[model samples]
Target chain A: MDLQTSKAPSPKLPHTALDRVVPHSESDWNDAAAPAAERHALIKSEAAGVQLNLGELWHYRELLYFLTLRDIKVRYKQTLMGVAWVIIQPLLTVLIFTLVFNRFVRLETGSLPYPLFALSGLLLWLFFANAVTNSTHSLVSNANLITKVYFPRMFIPAASVGAGLVDLSVAFLLLVALCFYYGVALTLQILLLPIFVLMMALLALGVGLFAAAVTVKYRDLRHALPFIIQLWMFASPVIYPTSVVPQKWKWLVTINPVAGIIEGFRAAITGQHFDWIHIFISLVITLAVLASAIYVFRRFEDTFADVV
Target chain B: MNTAIKINQVSKRYRIGGLHPGYMTFREMLGGLVTAPFRKLKSGNGSQTLWALSDINLEIGQGELVGIIGHNGAGKSTLLKILSRVTKPTTGEVELFGRIGSLLEVGTGFHPDLTGRENIFLSGAILGMRRKEIERKFDEIVAFSELEKFIETSVKWYSSGMYVRLAFSVAAHLEPEILMMDEVLAVGDAAFQHKCLDKMNAIRQQGRTILFVSHDMAAITRLCRRVVLLENGVVSFDGEAREVVKRYLSSSLKTGALKEWTNQHDAPGDQVARLRRVRVRTSDGVTTAVVDIRQPFGIEIAYDVLAEGHALVPVVEFYNEEGTELFSTHDTSSNWRRQPRPPGTYTSTVQIPGNLLAEGSLVGHVSIMSHFPATVLHAQERNAVAFQVVDGPAGDSARGDYIGPMPGVIRPLLQWTTETNELSPKSNVQSPTSAGNS
Candidate 1:
């Protein structure tokens, strides 16, 4: 390496836009009881990294927001009606599902207008699918960056979820409008909408991180993901109401936690009833999957640059 | 002084065949796999594992900018990946104090459909920059990128130059404390590249430690004080930038003359004059050669004139790493002679000078052809011997009047002009003046 650059004057003076006010030194990092070499690097890594430092990432959280915003704008760029696509997308999906299921299949929506019920589930699915797909391809496709530079591996998957959140928010408005059109009165249970959103986001992030790591090593997953996600949508109760599911098979529904979340959406928005059984089961499943995802993501994160 | 980044005994390995070209029927391929377990394990071409970097130990002090350079597959990229934490090292460790900002790629996370302004924030965020900072530098970055007019257009519509320009602008403008740039210079044209260098130079002024990589030797020589040379994932040389480039280029010279063998080896299209030994010698016809200062030297290529031909012209060309053709010479006058030495051993020697060529590796491209009805008997796009030209007395322009670095690859001996006034003319011009002093 021609280090004449070391002799090159410091970066254009007034180096203000750094991550931390107190620049961390290599020596200071070394003092931590991390592995001398690989272990040391692992220490700082988000997983098996020496330690997880939320404060450091928080300092640069603005970057995360910018990335999320970038993703949102990029999705709608060039196509007609930029931000409108966010709302139009779910609106169309709701229309299609309502036509196919409510009008044709005639699935009972349990006192809830079918359009409002379908959209509620659609909104959550969009976030999860987009997040998982983006995260799966993030490390491999960003070869230029991942191979060239390093950052927290989780950031890529997390940013995808964050970016998709903007779309989800815009799409959620349609669900609200549909509820109003159907004259479903607001209830205190609506406050719990955020908890479902968080659960969905976490679920998406966890699966997305796992997919991103696996795709780096197994290219087959790259090809398999879209089909798997499409199939996964069917497994979740997006197109139909969970009430029709036989009580005996309800346990199988818990296998796909989105089923529980979708049922919760129906319960919260319609103010009919809560599926505490499915919701509790869904939360547990989401946590198990998330912990495993983090563990797998961290395990594979170290090797990402090489494979990617 | 605190060390900003410390890497010790780091290594990275990759499985080859990410891109394999082959054909296999679906059923048979699966059947072979299924049966392989029953029969002796027939290892179908096992994947090759190559280590991109190994046993690298270095300490980067706080706010130290380092430039890394190496030949293709020399593990420079691998090292950068490890430093940036993009990939885990198979062994060894890296300890870093401050958050590292790596521009591993310009517009790495850019969504093509995204508008320039949006991509900026997105790419900026991916690089670990805050939205507010991206906003603060938004105008400046746009101005620097020279894409102010089309800021809202999707980046997919932007030309490659515009994309690179905007990408680099965002990366550098975002201002990470520790920055890593990899071949970022390869994207822009000459003027743009110069502009980028100046911008990078400006960025360096902020005391942010940086790591830059490029293929242009001149730029590398000018920008980097120290360079690391990697050979097979190991540091071969780590010191002065000039010396490392010199070492890398010099090693390219041929260690021995081309060997001669008349045995029946498959020759390209039998029409080619069977080549024997290609040698270098002095103008005096001495076999051994090294031209003294201001002395001339020649290259002697011996071959058997396998077939009769007319208008045969031999040419030699030299090139630098940047694909710049430094010089080429074709002996047109000799081709006109057409004195056929048919079916016999013949020697052709072209004389130039050892001192004339600049101090660098000069590889020769040789072509043999018959130009009667105009036919190329044998032509190799890239061929022949490489030699190193040692510096003599002349010096280069960038570092003037030195005992080294003669200007521009060739220091040809040439005549010069000076004017001295005639005695009678001087007397007439000074007639009204100093005559009385004599």
Candidate 2:
């Protein structure tokens, strides 16, 4: 109630047309009176549901790049292997799969060599696995940045995916080497490799978005995430081929979006028969998951700073 | 005037004490999800709502610098957070014009593993700067940080001071139409803090609207022309910076004079002792705001000792109006010094003799400690009691007849004696003549 109207002396500067001699109050803020060149930003609380503010995201794209770069640069900072870890991780996983599934269990991998088949699937699977794991904890890990500055929160998760893509590209080199070592011939179907990689990336991003948002509220996801990823890897056809599954149970495997992508990737790399029905089903499920993940991510984005 | 920022009826509500803790476990979440309907039917509402800010309305004009001053949890940071878009309010809206760069904390996005140079670009981008802008200002930022020799070195090797310098330099170079800063000056050394203030002054001179939130009254008064004082999530006063700061200081003094603990669970103490009541009173046992400088005053600290056979020492610290610690006095009474205190409620009074303190507001801090085992029974309650010391009548107090502001925290009335000699005139004349001859 103690509102003293004694205005402080204004600074001596060149006055613009917007300058006024009157006092500032709630009633004096007329949006129509402001010039068109003057940009205005409004802040509010009740932003419910999913609003993909693409413009805001686009504006902060540079920040996303820097964040992704930071993640990659810091990922291997003190490690002895550095970028070698990216290649070594998937290569080692493929070796273990070939040993356990091919040598011991003797799982059928169609006509393709077991190492070539498993490496192709393992390469994409590692990308998706690392991407989802990193993106799920991205917001919480950067809680300082989220609470201190104003940027699109989606950039944190998206940058995790972007950084994962860098690792994926590096690991892809190892896959090419493995294909040559196994004498697997590349066919025209290999041209569809980028599209399938994009689909797998989207599937990872969708799950990452959902997990990131949920982790902000329920930190239990942080503890349960590795277990979930372990289960998801077995659910996909990374260790074995999708063709070995029984016909009735094949529908259950296709429900996982990564299943068909892995199978399609192996086909593209080793020159096997491409399954159009499986690819189509995987693409549709990936799109649905991506759309809903984005929706859920945007819905929970407003509460991230508060709860995080 | 053209408004730079308009906040209308913005209220933020935070829920308290629900079945769900701040963090949720998978089992608890699953169980809650299953019984949510049943729990909803049984309990009307399981959580209580606290409005951190409620119905706050304000408008800041273009090129205006405003300081926000408040106690902790008075919603000062909340307002800054809402304006900066770091968090959203629960009700109403806020409109901001022009580009806004908010520095809520120093070194916000700094990655220790990254080099100082890499962190500069990363922090710059995090603060909404374009890569081109950072590239342009790269040398200037490095120069300002004074870490040119260590720019390529990882930030983890840099000292905390160097880290703050680099982080602040990047943020300082950010050119925004509107800037919001919250107590970022509290870090770094005093010299660096002055440099930051100089940079802030330069920013102010550019006709950019600035919203500064700080507890340092001197900085607030020096930088901001207008001040908004918030108390209990509402604008308590809005006026010139000096006047509002004075009001805030006096109000804090008034509130710090007395504290009572009705609940033992909520009292300030450890297992050994707990404070029951703390009061500033006159020698006659009357609680008053003003204490005459010629008369003694007392700080009555009533505490209950929860444990027996513990040597508890009561220490009281006095601070001036400027938050400068005047002095600290400890209870060395023979009774407690010789024997351990038994478990019982006890009242201890520390007396401030006349002519010992300057004529200004003095804040008292009370603490209880044990020495042999080196334990603090009760952490010091800073500003537990505050009282003003006014000058007494002329010829009776430390000030004597002078009616002006004293220089130091303590003005002791020391006695002086003068003796006149008959040879003093001759000596003075001889001394002047010898000096003139030389």
Indicate which candidate wins on DockQ. 2
TM-score of chain B of 2: 0.61
Q: Residue B7 lDDT in model 2? A: 94
lDDT tens per residue, model 2, B75-108? 9999999999988888889999887889999988
Q: Where does candidate 1 chain A have its weakest 10-residue lDDT segment?
A: A14-23
Candidate 1: tens digits of C-alpha lDDT, residues B45-130:
33456777878878777656566777898898777776777666777777875546676666777778778888887777777665
Interface RMS deviation of candidate 1: 10.4
Highest-scoring model, lDDT? 2
**lDDT by residue (tens digit), candidate 2, A1-308:** 01211132332322211122111333222334334323578786764335577777777778989999999999999999899999889888888888998899998877778888888888898899899999999999999888888888888988899999999999889988977887777789899899889998889889999999999989889889999999988888888776677798877897877898988888888777788888999999999999998888888877777778
How far is B182's C-alpha from truth in model 2 (Å)? 1.1
